[model samples]
Target: MIKDSPNPPEHLFAVRPNLDTETLLVNASQDLASISDIAVHLAFEVDGAQRNVALGICRMLEGVQLLVNKALDEAYPAT
Candidate 1:
């Protein structure tokens, strides 16, 4: 079950590793791809609103993937 918190802590934050840009991008791309795959699988396995939510997550991840790829291309242009 999901929990909802009203007025959630404003200072909530995660401590990120001190990784370089290329490493961070590679890690994020792999993680997001894994999440997208899981979301796609769960979406097909479920019905109604739950499936819709899962598909929505997949779509958001796809968008992020595109943006990340663009950043990668800009960072390391093709020869």
Candidate 2:
């Protein structure tokens, strides 16, 4: 007998269940900011329609970043 598939890796990239809301929101905000920066840079590197598409993605990411930052602020307000 043989197995059809091997076991999955033990160190898969996944959110830890024990993370608190503030930590999660902070991580999410950082990730969104990084993605937006990438999209902006790629927009400048491309031409025509592709550039437009990248810019559109950047805009959407910016909206999401705003939401995430707001949530983070609300979850952990400064003194």
Candidate 3:
């Protein structure tokens, strides 16, 4: 049987609206670090241009992680 219309998309994951800035920054920093690790590992598995691209992605993710960390530090200073 053919459907007349497409079914609505289901969102399996979403951020909690009540989360504070520090929590969000921490999560972002962790995610960026994880992605950077994956990229670095992938870079080793490939060669030439593909390897360069993966390493480049790793570098960019590192920069983003630094930014997130800075924001977190600024938002919640240590005693």
lDDT of each structure? 0.88, 0.90, 0.91
- Which pairs of residues collide in model 3? none
A best-first ranking of the candidates according to their TM-score comes to: 3, 2, 1
Q: Over 4 Å off in model 2, which ranges?
A: 1-12
Residue-pair clashes per prediction, in order, are: 0, 0, 0
Q: Residue-wise lDDT of candidate 2 within 6-43, one digit each (tens)?
A: 77667768777998998889888889989999999999
Name the lDDT value of residue 64 in candidate 1: 100
Please identify which of the two predictions, 1 or 2, would achieve the higher lDDT against the true structure. 2
Off by over 4 Å in 3: 1-12
lDDT of candidate model 1 versus the reference: 0.88
